[model samples]
Target: MQIATLAIIGASPPVRLARMPHIELPRALEDYFAFAETEPTRNGRRFSITLPYMDGERLDRLQWWYHVSPAQEQMYEGTGLVFHRTRAIERFCRHIERWLEITAQRFHGEEPIPRLGQQASSVATPASVELTPVDKVVNA
Candidate 1:
């Protein structure tokens, strides 16, 4: 199966792919928001949400996040599962595939992706990250 995309030139997190056949993003997202322990960030062109979930009887353990940046001429936001101790988010994504493995591709597939803005690698980052009140993120 072929994957199609409409990439905006010079955009940080370019427009989301036109859906992949093997990936179940809808079910993945539904599982993401259903019972995610959300940490609200500032709103506007730049915002982020960090969810640390261990277990909820109905939800699985997943360190996930969703973020958007303004400085990169970003017309779209970014999201994915956190790499926690070799744990695959596919457990929540309802599909079998590493999140970044497939996403980190395109013309720049072979290049080393830069680590921008201190993005978290594992389920936990340093204390420099500040957290605020939880709010429903409605991007419009």
Candidate 2:
């Protein structure tokens, strides 16, 4: 199945990614967030949630992938599965919903960073990312 990883940029704990396609993301994401070695880009910070395929509950391989950059207001999405399969499409949709739920919880509101006499302007707000087309990513 082709799976897409949701990403959120500019948020605290600046790196987060889904580890598996079948597993749901935890409510408290303290230890679940991940960061891979990627080249620096104009976007503030890139957080990825890559979803690998499951073979009857066992992870087989990565098929589809997604990368969201809130700073750049962009989402890159792609899949590698052949078009002849319908299961891949269904799995991808399920992954997308789960990803959205996790993102909503992680970035619900602007909880200002606590600092004595800090200017409000210095605070950051949630912004939309631009969508970019990409090829599916494989785990290295």
Candidate 3:
């Protein structure tokens, strides 16, 4: 006699990759929001996304990997396991989503800055200069 066990896993959560289009960007990150775009593409047999660097500088390309399920795998045989179903693929997608959120906030300047305008005054300057009245003027 032979014994075999089978297990079933629940369906995965709704996940999608958000795409970003090309646009003119600032030299420094401070002016990022001046040009930024978001583009979304559904996961399909050929599931892959590319992030472009707006600046002219040469840099490594950013790529993401996705895994598809057995059923989906069979449907798209030539596409390979890169886009086939797997837990690692789902985890990668989740991480990418979180990264996108943080990147957007950073580029848009949504992140709060500490002590943006608050500064402490020092007493090193002369007392007369510090106490000078704005309405009063001294003859040269």
RMSD of each: 23.3, 25.3, 18.1
Report the lDDT tens digits of candidate 1 across residue range 53-111: 32222323334433332333232243212222012222433331244335531111111
| Tens digits of per-residue lDDT for model 2, 2-115 | 334433333322222334432343332222333242454665333333333333334432233333344323422222111111233345545544654554411221122111
Cα lDDT over the full model 2: 0.35
Clashing pairs in 1: none
Clashes of 2: 13
Sort by TM-score, best first: what order? 3, 2, 1
Question: With candidate 3 superimposed using the best TM-score fit, by how many Å does residue 51's alpha carbon deviate from the native?
Answer: 1.5
lDDT (Cα, 0-100) at 52 in candidate 1: 28
lDDT of each candidate versus the true structure: 0.31, 0.35, 0.34
Stretches of candidate 1 off by over 4 Å are: 2-57, 65-96, 99-140
Best by TM-score: 3
Question: Over the stretch 1-140, how does candidate 3's per-residue lDDT look in tens digits?
Answer: 22112111332332332332111122322212121213423443334433433222333333454434445655544433433333334454355346545554222213221111112334478656455458877899
lDDT of 1 at 80: 17
